[model samples]
Target: MKSVSYAGLTFETADEIADALLQLAAALGVNERSETVDIPVVEQNGDLSSVQLVIGPASQFISKPVTSPYNEPASAEVVERLTYRTRLLDLPRAAAISDSEIGRLDFDSPA
Candidate 1:
């Protein structure tokens, strides 16, 4: 049987994970839609062994208020200006040295 684990919880199958997320959302007074939840999943058959943190669907455990710099208009404007000014550096040309030139150069030269 496939299994997924997060925080201190373990869930077997996608349905169980969905139900658990719904319960968690309900506990936190947040409405969870069946179609909206995007749970991190990995499928494997046999005894429950591997475990990982669920990222997308589980937001109930986040104690701190999530903030984005882009959420603010000023920050977004600054980011946009910086991004617009950014330019890709031109590729440097490779040195074209012949075997005769290699022999002429010192084998041990200090930088």
Candidate 2:
């Protein structure tokens, strides 16, 4: 239960923010070591302290191909067709929280 230190929200509600952070932590697969990191949250449409738990470390993550290696490289047109997910947020679980300042974000969905 770590406290997120950010000044984006107009009003700070520790309980709601904490719950959202915890949910995001599990979805992002954060372990015991990842400290809070800046993440894109759907608030005033800016960055916020979502969580430090990332799918992979920066080095390993940046090296991966857009598509799997076994599969042939995607054509330029095919690559253009790809779009990132933005609405994959879990609503049912998040409903319990009523933090208007924090807003709702599909934290786990690909940016």
Candidate 3:
């Protein structure tokens, strides 16, 4: 289990979810973007809840390991979604240049 502190409030979630959330936040920060996401978390009373987090370039988070007996919230879908979004944010969206295109450009260039 991991405790993620954001906006002065702490929420507990699975280790993978916490890690994925951090990664997504970094990606969003690098891109100077923001997003609202709902993450499955365990409340202090051991009840399941989905907390909405608004993360962006200025967002700050603190994640730490925590010992909890309650079964880590099953949030594979959340983790997968976060991972996918993080990867999308990290990808460079420029068009790909083929080897032939590069060769043509090289030949057309002045010596």
lDDT of each: 0.37, 0.30, 0.92
Worst lDDT window (10 residues) for model 3? 101-110
Q: Identify the runs in model 1 with alpha carbons over 4 angstroms from their true place.
A: 1-17, 29-43, 50-111
What candidate 3 gets wrong by more than 4 Å, as runs, is 94-111
Measured by TM-score, the strongest candidate is 3
Displacement of the residue 60 alpha carbon in candidate 3, Å? 0.9
Report RMSD (Å) for each prediction in the order shown. Answer: 20.4, 20.5, 5.3
lDDT of 1 at 79: 32
Clashing pairs in 3: none
lDDT for each residue of candidate 3 in 5-99, tens digit (9 for 90 to 100): 99998999999999999999999999999999999999888899989999999989999999998889997899999999998987878888998
Residue 110 shift from truth in candidate 3, angstroms? 12
Local error of candidate 1 at residue 8 (angstroms): 19
lDDT of 3 at 34: 98
Model 1 accuracy (lDDT, Cα): 0.37
Off by over 4 Å in 2: 1-13, 30-111
Error of 2 at 34 (Å): 9.3
